[model samples]
Target: MKKIYLLFISCLAAFILNLILMNSAADMPVFFTSYLNDLLCMPIVLSICLFLIKSFSRKKSIRISLFSAFSLAALYSVYFEIYLPKVNTRYTADFTDVLLYFSGSLIFWLTHKFDSPKNIQKTT
Candidate 1:
């Protein structure tokens, strides 16, 4: 729970910074302007989703499976990078974004930890 909160807050901070950079006129590196958001997308989104799931399920020991995380990254890549680019002028296809999405998932997977049953304390 602490780890998830930290991950969520850190990613949220990065996202806010990125949003500021996006809206500001200050010249920034391409990474900050473009790829940073892509790199952050999954962790931020997944953290929120996981938080909601945990809240509703009333479970403190739940964590996302690696396969589920990977599948979501793949789905986002296909939809945003492949499909959206073809249909929307605002979107552009970039294979690097696909890699970044998976990278973000991996980051989320590594950082999103919860106590196991053995470690959880039972209240009397």
Candidate 2:
């Protein structure tokens, strides 16, 4: 659980760095400026969601936590990839972004499950 909190903090730092690289005028590769931030979207949101779940819930449940992570990812994907483009001139829908969100959510879910002590059964 403490490690999960650390992971969330690290993800937050990466997200902030992505924001900086996306907005900075400094000369850099397009990958850093455009795709990097998009790639980080899922992990950022998923981590925050998972962190909140662990923080507030007295009895932590993996199923519930994973559900919340993916649900938030889905909502974010829809809002950013579908709704935002229609409402804002600056935002445009990209399928890659949607894929990234799903991919990130899946990765987070798998890693969390594997790393959790509760998931490991002792062979007596």
Candidate 3:
């Protein structure tokens, strides 16, 4: 239950933040626009969610988490690509957005290597 709640909250936070970025006109910091945003937040959120689930429950594969991360990110892109542009007129879909989404998911997977608490402990 806690895992579910955590995942829900984290993903919700990411989704809402993404939406705000999509809608806002204020100038974002350079890092936020310079392709590092994918590495910073979304991946961290997903990886932490994966880490939390592994910490809480049965040891399962990460395949499901990766798939879910990719799916959710892609779905978010597609939805906004279609709707936001139609509704807001200010939002436009760029191929770079798709690239960023994929990069975010990939980074999320890459961070999974460090997701295990067992690895965080000193073995010797």
Candidate 4:
């Protein structure tokens, strides 16, 4: 579907931009380079997968997507911030990364409003 394609492209663009920022100027804030990517990765990837699978009620899709994103963020936070640090000294626990992950999910939920069924014009 067109919507799925669009979402995919958008996610791809974000990923590319993230990579660019990561390798670009060292002056870039940590939030803009690493934290921002962590925050955005879940929502974008999850949304792409959901949209590709099938269509559901708009509200239901939104709810499920948000839940999935949050779950992933939690898992990621616990792994990277808690578990990984215990095993690897290189991995430092950072609460700010967790916060950024949540922020990213929240942003996805907010921006997703534009993609709601009520907002999309159905082709006849």
- Each candidate structure's TM-score, on Cα atoms with residue i matched to residue i, is 0.87, 0.75, 0.50, 0.65
lDDT by residue for model 1 (1-124), tens: 4676787788889989789878986788899887988898899888887877778876666678778788899999999999998999999999999999999999887776342435443211
lDDT of 2 by residue, 1-124 (tens): 5555565567678879877766786787877776666666666666665557658867555333566667777898899989999999899898877777777777666656666666542210
Poorest stretch of ten by lDDT in candidate 3:
115-124
The full ranking of all candidates by TM-score, starting with the best, is: 1, 2, 4, 3
Clashes of 4: 0
Task: Give the residue spans of candidate 1 off by over 4 A.
Answer: 114-124
lDDT of the structure predicted as candidate 4 = 0.66
lDDT of 3 by residue, 1-124 (tens): 3343344456557656765785684777755554454434456556566557658756454333456777767776777666688889778766677677777776655445344535432110
Supply every candidate's count of residue pairs whose N, Cα or C atoms clash at under 3 angstroms: 0, 0, 0, 0
Cα displacement (Å) at residue 36, model 1: 0.3
lDDT of 3 at 108: 57
Q: How accurate is candidate 3 locally (lDDT)?
A: 0.59
Ranking by lDDT: 1, 2, 4, 3
TM-score for candidate 3, residues paired by index = 0.50
| Better structure of 2 and 4 per TM-score | 2
Winner on TM-score (1 vs 4): 1
The whole-model C-alpha lDDT of candidate 1 against the native structure comes to: 0.82
Q: Which candidate number maximizes lDDT?
A: 1
What is the number of residue pairs that collide in model 3? 0
Better of 1 and 2 by lDDT: 1
Give the Cα error of residue 100 in candidate 1, in Å: 0.5
